[model samples]
Target: MILRTSRLDLREMTEDDLPALRAILQDAETMTAYEGAFDEEMVQAWLHRMRDRYRDDGFGMWAVVLRESGEMIGQCGPTVQHILDEDVLEVGYLFNRAHWHRGYATEAAAAVRDHVFRALGADRLFAQVRDMNVASMNVAIRLGMTVRGRFVKNYRGVDMPHLAFAIDAPPTGREHGVSAAPPERRRER
Candidate 1:
C-alpha cells in the first residue's frame, strides 16, 4: 500500500530495504527506546517477519520515504498487538536518528492513523508508548489520541512500562487540526 503526505511516501517494506532498515534499527542511539539495538541477524529476521505479516495479515509497518530526496527515513503503520491483555490495532513507528525532530514521525503516524480508520474501517486505533519515550508520546498526542492507561511489557528480560493512547475514527470528515476548506485548499493529496 502507498500513502502520501505533504513530505513522505509510505509503502510496503521489501527485502531491498534491509540496508536502510538496519541503519535505523541497528543504531544503538536510534533504538534506545527499546532495550538495545538489533543485530544484523535480527534485522534480517525483522524484515522477514514484516514480509510474512504482509502475506498473513495483509497489513504491516511500512517504509517511510522522503519524497524529495527519495531516502527512507523510517517505518510506520498498523499492527495487531496485545495491550492491556486485549488485542488492539496499534500504530507503531521508528525513525533514523538523523531524521529525528523533523516531524516525520508525527506526519507518517497521523496518515497511518487516518488509514486505519478511513481505509481499514476500524473504529479506533492505539499506540503503545514506552513510559520513557516522551517524544513518541507527544506524537501520539498530536495524532489526537488520549492517554488511556498504563501497562507493563516484558521485553528481553526487562520490564518496560508503557502508556496506552487511543483515538476513534472521526465522526464524519472531522479530523483534528484539519480545517474545513474548499476543495482546492484541502490537503487530501
Candidate 2:
C-alpha cells in the first residue's frame, strides 16, 4: 500500500532501500535512540523479515520517501509487538539523522495512524518509546496517544524504561471539525 502526504510518500520497502536503511540503522546517534546499532547483515535480515510480515499479515512498516527528491527518509507502520502480557499492533518509526527536526516523523506517524484506524479498521494503536527519548514522546502526544503504562526491561540488553501510548479509535467527522456534507451541498450548488 502507498500513502501520500503533501511532501512525503509512504510505500512498501524495496530491495534497493537496503543501502539507505542500513546507513540509517548504523548511525550511532540514531541507534542510540533505538535499541542498538544494526549491522549490514542484520539490516538485510530485518528487511526480509518485514517482507515476510507483509506477505503474512498484509501490513508492515513502510519506507517514507521525500516526494520532491525521491529520497528515503525513514519507515513507519504497524507491527505486532510482543510485550510482557500479550501481542499488540504497535505503530513504530525511525528516521535518518539528516531528516531529524523536520517534522517528518510526526507527519508520517499521523498518516499511518489515520490509515491504521480508517483503512485497517484498527480499534486501537500503540507505541513504545524509551523514556529518554523526549522527541518521540512529543510525537506520541501529537498523534493524540495517551501513555498507558511503562515497563522496566532490557531493551537491547540495556535496562531502560519503555513508555506505551495508545489511541482507542479513529476520530469521526465531527471530531475533526469537518462537516458531514460538502460545502456546495450544505449550501446550494
Candidate 3:
C-alpha cells in the first residue's frame, strides 16, 4: 500500500530497500535510541520480518521515500506491537540520521495516524517511545498523542523504559466538522 504526504511517500518495503535501510539501521547515531546499531544480517532479518507482517497483518512498517527523487529515506507505518499485555496498533518509524529535524517524521506520522483512523478504522493508535528518545516523543506529541503511561522492555539484555502515547478517533461528524467541510456547508439548516 502506498500513502502520501506532501513531501514523502510511504509504500510497502521490499528487499530492494536494503541498502538505504542499512545506512540508517546500521548507523550507531541513528539507532542510538534503541538497543544499538543493527548488523547486515540483522538488517536483512528486519526486512524479512516486515514482509511477514504485511502478509499476516496486512500492514507493517513501510519504506519512506522522497517523492521527487524516489529515494528510500527510511521506514514508517503501523504495526501490531504487544504492549501492556495486549496487541496494540503502533505507528513505528525510523529515519536516516540525515533526514532528522526536517519535520519528516511528524509529517509522515500524522499521515499514518489518519490512515489508521480513517482507512483502517482503528479506534486508537499508539507510539511506544523510548523514554530518552525526546525527538520521537515530540513527534508523537505533534501527532496529537498524549503519554498514557510508562513501561519497560528488555532489549538486547538491557531494560529500556518507554512511554506509551496514544490518540483516539474523533466521534462521528466530529471528524469532518468545520475545517474538513466548508463552513457554509457545516452551518445548521
Candidate 1 Cα errors over 4 Å, as ranges: 173-189
- Which numbered prediction scores highest in lDDT against the true structure? 1
| Model 2 per-residue lDDT tens digits across residues 132-188 | 998889999999999998876575667887888888885566667776687778586
lDDT of each: 0.91, 0.86, 0.90
Q: How should the candidates be ordered by TM-score, best one leading? A: 3, 1, 2
Q: Could you say which candidate leads in TM-score? A: 3
- The TM-score that candidate 1 achieves is 0.89
Which stretches of candidate 3 lie above 4 Å from their native place?
A: 174-189
Instruction: Kindly indicate the candidate among 1 and 3 with the higher TM-score.
Output: 3
Between 2 and 3, whose TM-score is larger? 3
Sort order, lDDT high to low: 1, 3, 2
Q: What TM-score, computed on C-alpha atoms, does each candidate reach?
A: 0.89, 0.87, 0.91
Angstrom error at residue 81, model 1? 0.4
Runs off by more than 4 Å, candidate 2: 171-189
